[model samples]
Target: MDNNMLILSEGMHTSIQDLGRKGYRAFGVPISGAMDKYSAILANKLLNNDEKLPVMEMTLIGPKILFEDNSLIVLTGADMAPHINGEAIQMNFVYKVTTSDVLSFGNLKTGARTYLGVKGGFLTEEKLNSFSYYEGVTSKEKVQKGDRLKIASIEAGLNPSSSKIKVKSAHFKEKKLEVTKGPEFNRLTKKHRELLFSKEFKIDAHNNRMGYQLKNKFPPIKNGEIITSTTIPGTIQLTPSGKLIIMMRDCPTTGGYPRILQLTDIAINQLAQKKENDSFKFDLESSFDFLGRLVNRFKD
Candidate 1:
């Protein structure tokens, strides 16, 4: 019931993303949502908002905005060098913007995606129990220009906190992502698996809402008759030509051609932040073994 923010100039590809549309993949709807969840969760949690509330998920950079009323918001993930009314804003913290104040985000830094959580959830019409998924949607579209965002809270006289208390931060600290070996991971030649971790792979610029293409030595497989099977986000599928594609939040519900491996939850979040030329190592593990490690990770 709050009119806090309004989309003035929609950026290249900004979407109202939460987690994803669960339980509807069987109907051929891709799991559509934000690519990097770590930042998204962190940004929203700072404001004590629910995980299901839709937020502005941006790739590379964010769009310009003009507030309909005074609001406080927080930003997380890669720094995109934002500015408010020609005054630069800080990263990884919460700040305030007033009505008619213009805000712009520059190019992305180290990572690919960033999350911005306003005082409350971004209020968009819920279509099919979600504002996240945006395929075959007749009611709510992804997001368009001149759209008025319905927020949850209002400010009688609330404005940017003048005290200027800096926001503290948390360490993502995730590196050397673990993976569950694929159905065709063993099918590749012994040298292929060796080369996978042996050399570093660079993320390609051909990335978008769908997936990221990783470039490396390009492995080979002898027998490639794997049936068309179910695929999910974080699935690392390899083409016959040996190119690796890490399915993102908007990834297809299913695929074929045999995936090489599956990135764990922690790893996929970090992978979503990677832009072109970012290099990282991949570690292979058994499904049960990796799951146990993840369970332990959450415990700690």
Candidate 2:
């Protein structure tokens, strides 16, 4: 039988995602990719596949998939209580399955997103140099029931022992997100700056792939509107109404709001795993200090 996964049920917001489209932001194209890139990369790494290969990004809930051929797969990011043929399985572990095996999920114990990585990756449509499925950029925005995802057929004598890895649970429970000052951060008053770092902000209900809005607000900036400057993922924009919007992977290439702070790459990944109403505080770091830490991290 041909290698394929039949989606019996498309839970919550499952979609195909990769690292995201690069070099097309100049054309007003947003980088629509995996929300928790660190987890997505981990999934691929466990399977010995290309880190940027496409994987199923499951949000809140997970899909019910049926394997049509022998395959190797792994789950990472969220503790979604995954099961294979009614037997519970652990996350961050590699498992080999034969044809007719059914993969399903139970309650999401932690984190907001999960990555399902299959050996050889999924054979999905690629657009603009990426496999990420964006609404307007791709044919379909999210995976739907009845969708059949193509995969590489397992070869003879390719079975390998299952493997598992340990991941720190604190990663999902982290409440401090590191940030660097943005170009307009200096424009804010000292009070606003202090409140931003000291006060806890809750994730607003409007959170999604486009961006995350904070429930708490600060008084309007003296000069709130910007001259349509460039914006990227993790850019924290302060609106005139004092709302804070944290741009995500699918945010527009440019925004008019005043950019006040920028989240570090690690912080962005941490934020992506947060759900609505989740609370967090900003941990400001100077550019020089951040760079020094980055250099030291690479040296280690």
Candidate 1 residue 258 Cα shift, in angstroms, is 0.9
The reply for model 2, stretches above 4 Å from the true place, is 293-300
User: Which regions of candidate 1 are displaced past 4 Å?
Assistant: 1-4, 138-142, 155-175, 285-291, 294-300
Put down candidate 1 lDDT per residue, 1-300, tens digits, no spaces: 246677877776777788777777888887676677767877777666786667787777678888776677877777788888878787666677666777788876556666778877777767666678475753555456787777666557655443323332322334466688776677777777778777778888788778889767385566554678988888888887777888877778778878888888778888777777877888777667867887898994
Candidate 1, residue 134: CA error in Å?
Answer: 2.0
- 10 residues in a row with least lDDT, candidate 1: 164-173
Clashing pairs in 2: none
lDDT of 1: 0.73
lDDT per residue for candidate 2 within 179-207, as digits (tens), equals 99998999999898888889999999999
Give the lDDT of residue 13 in candidate 1: 77
